[model samples]
Target: MSSVTIEARHEAWPLREAFVISRGAKTAADVVVVEAIDGAHRGRGEAVPYARYGETVEGVIETIRSAAVHISSHADLTRFLKPGAALNALDCAFWDLESKRTGIAVSARAGLPHPIAKITAFTLSLDTPSVMAEKAARVPHLSLLKLKLGGTGDDLRMQAVRQARPDAHLLVDANEAWTTETIGAFLTAAVECDIELIEQPLPAGHDDILADIPHPVPLCADESVHTADNIETLLGRYDAVNVKLDKAGGLTGAMRLVAEARRHGLKIMIGSMVATSLAAAPAMLLAPYADWIDLDGPLLLARDREHGLHIENGIIQPPDPQLWG
Candidate 1:
């Protein structure tokens, strides 16, 4: 009488173009995939191992494999794995497995409304002012744009992109590349560029400077806050929190952070690391609660798997069950 079986593997998908951030560049998204099988039902989950979080694909798969034998239920998953890429994949797998076995959608199980199509922020990789402007111009149809910013000459980059796409909603992500000397000027540039939000202008654990800075544009915490427990400490520093399943363990843990953030009056940004639609699908369940949606991962890929989430222009339709919940 076999109960549930677990399996995990790594996959690499080529990017349409190099994804450049303050951290560096990547031409491919290497992801870890988790599977849970029970009788004739099968569930899947995908997560990108982020190097910034010190997670590698090999390490993530190993962790999942070692803990697989002990995981049979949601509570068992939590007890066996700590929060990270490994746990996130397993948690999401459990969600899909439950939905498959019980015939209940994830949103219904969690008492949330079914996901509807929504517009998402299309990201422009970090580049020179002129290059960034050209990239922004290429996507003239996209109404929302998220710019990957590097500190030294970011003001000109913002001005350039904004000039090219005056009709677009602008969001800036420094990826913690801005220094104290540059942050002041950068904040002013965001105002001049009509930027709506800024993410992680300074490094985590070194973001105290944000307390004294006057935010003409709202700041959102990406690297600073991980779990629900980190919300209260970020009160004055950030106006919002960016929730990524990779950072929060999975949908289960992300909901905890979302609830905590709302309680403290912090707005939410539902975001993701560049991966396939499989990874993006589960995050969409939380989209209704977000002030901004940055789940354009599939659009950045050279090609995605069949039956993936359908995103056209800048609007994304909810995931098809053939893909996942």
Candidate 2:
């Protein structure tokens, strides 16, 4: 077996503007990048340490450094670390390294078809109804728009956005800001606004109310579902799931979740944290299996990595091997 070396670093990329959600706002994306080196081959991966999940940049880097001593192979790395941003970075680095060493695309190694360019959902940050509408009007060419909504005046926000871009398909993400009682009202407004999906209207553990309600607009679980282990419990409550590598650990776990979610007839949505194209590339591989794609993280940044995934009129081009697998 060839010897391996691991290095990790934290990078902060400024966002074009503040990305506001129900929880709060962020001006920059602080991410941990992991690089695995084996002889002449090198692999790289990036992950954002999410504060909502009790993750910090320093903590993630430490976790990667500690795990590097024991992880000699990609297979070992899978079971070596728990599902989170730390493992995600290392896992993706392994995939990238293997791809470079063997000259095989990561998709081919995973038994997935070659990915093609696809339309991705452009996100509109949370703001007042009129501000949201103005933002929506500016991106008229984008076929899909994912709106960030707070519990209050969410209906008005949806209405204004709908009025601004009548032709675009809309997805609403409340980010667990709404209560069980308010979700029904939101769904009612979603229907009126012709919204196709409403994501994580209620908090994760408080989603029991979903089982008893009638869903006019399909509800997608962002926080309520993580890896495949959480899928069975969400069968009746959620119509779809938002899979992010940061949340699923890496492509390995995300693929498992995708397969399991599909087996249970749940719709799939490939989502991302506000990170760079390196972080978005791995998630794009799963876009083929997803009903909704939201890999617009790099587009939200002021500048992205060299040779990053290309986005033209809201469509994402496949990643170059140099950028990632």
The TM-score, computed over Cα atoms with residue i paired to residue i, of candidate 2 is 0.99
Error of 2 at 23 (Å): 0.6
In candidate 1, which residue ranges exceed 4 Å CA deviation? Answer: none
Give stretches of model 2 more than 4 Å off: none
Tell me each candidate's TM-score: 0.98, 0.99
- Assess candidate 2 and give its lDDT: 0.93
Write candidate 2's Cα lDDT for 1-325 as tens digits. Answer: 4988999999999999999999999999899999999999999999999899899999999999988999899988866799999989999999999999999999999988789888999999999999999999998789899999989899999999999999999999999999876877888899999999999999999889899999999999999888999998998899999998998989999999999999999999999899999999999998889899999999899999998999999999889999998
The C-alpha lDDT values of all candidates are 0.91, 0.93
lDDT of 1: 0.91
